[model samples]
Target: MKRFLWILFLGVTFSSTAQRMVLKKGRVLDSIPVAHNATDNFGLYLPKNYDASQKWPVVFVCDMKGDGLNVLENYKTSAEKQGYIFISINNLTDTLSISKNVLIANRIIVGASAIFSINPSRVYVAGFEEGARFASILPVFIGNVDGVISCGSDIGSIEILDAKNPFHYIGIVGKGDFNYTNMLQTENVLNKLKFPNQLLTFEGGHDWPPAKKLEEALEIFSLSSMVKGNNPKDKSFIEASYNASWERINSLIYSLKMLEAEDLITQTESVYPRLVGLDSLKEKLRQLKKNKIYKTQKRDENAAFNKESLTRVDYAYYLEEDVNTYNFKNLGWWSYQMDELKKHSASPNAIESQMGERLMGFLNALIQENIGTLKKEDPIDEEGLRFLWMLKTITAPKEYSNYLKVISSSAKNDDFGTALFYTEELLKKGYTNKSELYDLKDTALLRITPEFNELVAQYLKGARYELPIE
Candidate 1:
């Protein structure tokens, strides 16, 4: 691995004075301390065409790592294109109580509105992954929020969705993402409840969709406003939006993306009645619904779900037993199960492949929820943590922190060989934190050894520490 310099900047606090927020247009204000607390900082972005005299929609975003700037970057382009104010707190974590983060979000909302012309009727929340779940639940508690734009995840709790006060929901998920099924289920529930919603599917997994996808989500909100007469509906704007959506639906059908095509057709069917180009859209939708490919795909989807349920039940039982007994011997069994899932994901049968992706996603969610519960024990469950870290290493190899945890646990138990092995693995994953490599907890003995130093030198070239460098 090549040496990479990582710079971490501290959030700049703004005093709560009488002056309005002095902000530049079109650039992310990396951090703005909410309530003058460093830990309460949020990223803010204003459209280049922003006008203080006119009200604009404002979106509050969240990320699990409190990486406000990073999440905002994924959203700013779409926000700028749509002319919305955006803000996100960099202090939320899944381990923290949701109420605590809600308070942080509320503070930013109130603070931003005080200084900007944020339209209360258009207040929305958006987030990715765990943050997406957090955003989904906010409209229930925060009455000011009008809707939610959830990416890569679904609602934290469907119980919180109030039918009487239904808010708009725009779910953007990837077909290969673990939460794809969750989003699909959410769409049905939302539709059944008469909630205005749309589920947009792309082509990848467990990651943010492209900027254009984000723009489509914002467009949903914009279109909704026009329908409700909150914003004046210009005929041209409505036609352009309708034509754009029609083109996307047509493209999905032509590319054999039957599921995505069906979703878009359903969406436009429900929505086009109120917009321009309804006749043409209805004809296109009619043809799509009658297509042989569409019928076959829907049947296959149902079959896949039934098969996946059986497989999930079997795996769930063994995984629960393994966790209950701390069965290290079953680690190989778990590994095999994971491999099977990967294989199915690559299968030629499209339905089987989708089911595989959903199952993998389900497993990851199960382990994560278990880990969250286990961590809240009075005295932390080290053994449980170790088990989860090991599971995460296999299930989510891209997550380097779990590997670090395993290395730490091994070092604490004086398992130098295991610790060194993970260190090498972590470095192989392209981790560049040389400082933390030596400073890893309970690794004093292992960090000084030639084997560890040699491994470090292989990655971080000039590192030839005969003795502990520190």
Candidate 2:
């Protein structure tokens, strides 16, 4: 049999069992059986479009019920464009999908680094409803995951998403989805827990991801990185901007974790903290108390929806209380959208880019403040600024030329240490720190451009230190 999942991606992506995305196909490992008389299909999914020239980041998806590959199948092209490798653990039962998917996500990550050119630091987990539950509590299983994304899942009632590691997270759901109430609480819990994540709500429920939501999901996925450095500016603005981005990113992550806990697991095992947050919120934010309830509902504002089939979601069953699945039909609140949520956000990549750009942007704003201060004028509020130089950093025409100028100028001034720092920044693909060494050999500086000379000089100067690249 071709299996139930292949049909889900029918006519969309090819199903060549021989092709791979990130994992070796037909490679068996420690067994994870499904049920009596049925052996579990434990393997990897290496997308057909994957390229091997450079190391790739990995995204591990749990809840592969034959359709485990469906997530990556249609989206491999998009993911590959970002240089990411997608891996899925299939043959998961709906009942045990979370647990099994977690185990596989962890196992492949450990092996991926050794077997492939996978960046150990850039690993991530993703899931849906039940699958999302597994993705939500990921910190409980692995010590390091770059990011997470979940939809319609049961995020257990716990503070499993550790705040220290700084993982990225995002949640997507229909306002009236069958599990909508749980999804809302999931966000509340995340806000309390302070995980770095984002939330995007649509107008439908308990169904496969609608096409419109996919763009937001991809935006979150792209934002889940840890590249560092910021534009040079007066110190205070740089510090404040980076700090705010950290705060916002961390809160969103906590939100996504909670979303997963609600949909993926069999129980609401760790929701007490969320209760505490709501209690605290009532006192701090008066408007939030007005509703005293943010459970998922049936009414929708989404233009692409079927209102006749939708139902209203009103119960907060997955709160600091009980857990129940409105499985028989469309759960009341988990079926539709809120027609009036047209808030202005940036472009698709803006949220993702903001994580880093804001830091630089903040730095630049701070520079502006400092410049004004030097001119004997008023300064800018720290919170009012949010910007980043990621695209500008890449597109600047004088990027390399300026690098040489800065390094050459620093070196001629005899600032060896500063020169070394700049060259290394380029080596690490980091921006900000200017280098001083632009031209140096054992006997004389090279005739190359200042930027190239700086790096070459540094390498030869400390030929013993042995920097990467020739």
Q: Rate the local accuracy (lDDT) of all candidates.
A: 0.81, 0.44
As for candidate 1, its clashing pairs are: none
RMSD of each: 6.6, 24.9
Error of 2 at 248 (Å): 21
* lDDT of model 2 at position 387: 12
Model 2 residue runs over 4 Å out of place are 1-49, 94-101, 224-470
Lowest summed lDDT window (length 10), candidate 2 = 336-345
Q: How many times do residue backbones clash in model 1?
A: 0
Model 2, range 1-470, lDDT digits (tens) per residue? 21111111111123322222223322222222222213333334443444455556677776645666566665555554444566665655555555665665565566555555676566777778667776767767787776676776547545555556555566776544545445556667766777655566654545556654554454334433322211122345334433443354336434533222222221111221121123432332333223322122111212112321122112222210111221313212221111111111132322222222222222233334433443452463211111111111222322544344434545555555555554565445534322333233221343333544445555444331233466
Considering every candidate listed, which one attains the maximal lDDT?
1
Estimate, for each residue in 11-73, the C-alpha lDDT of model 1 and write its tens digit: 334333433445577788876655545566678888888877798998888788768787677
Candidate 2 residue 437 C-alpha distance from true site, Å? 84
TM per prediction: 0.83, 0.41
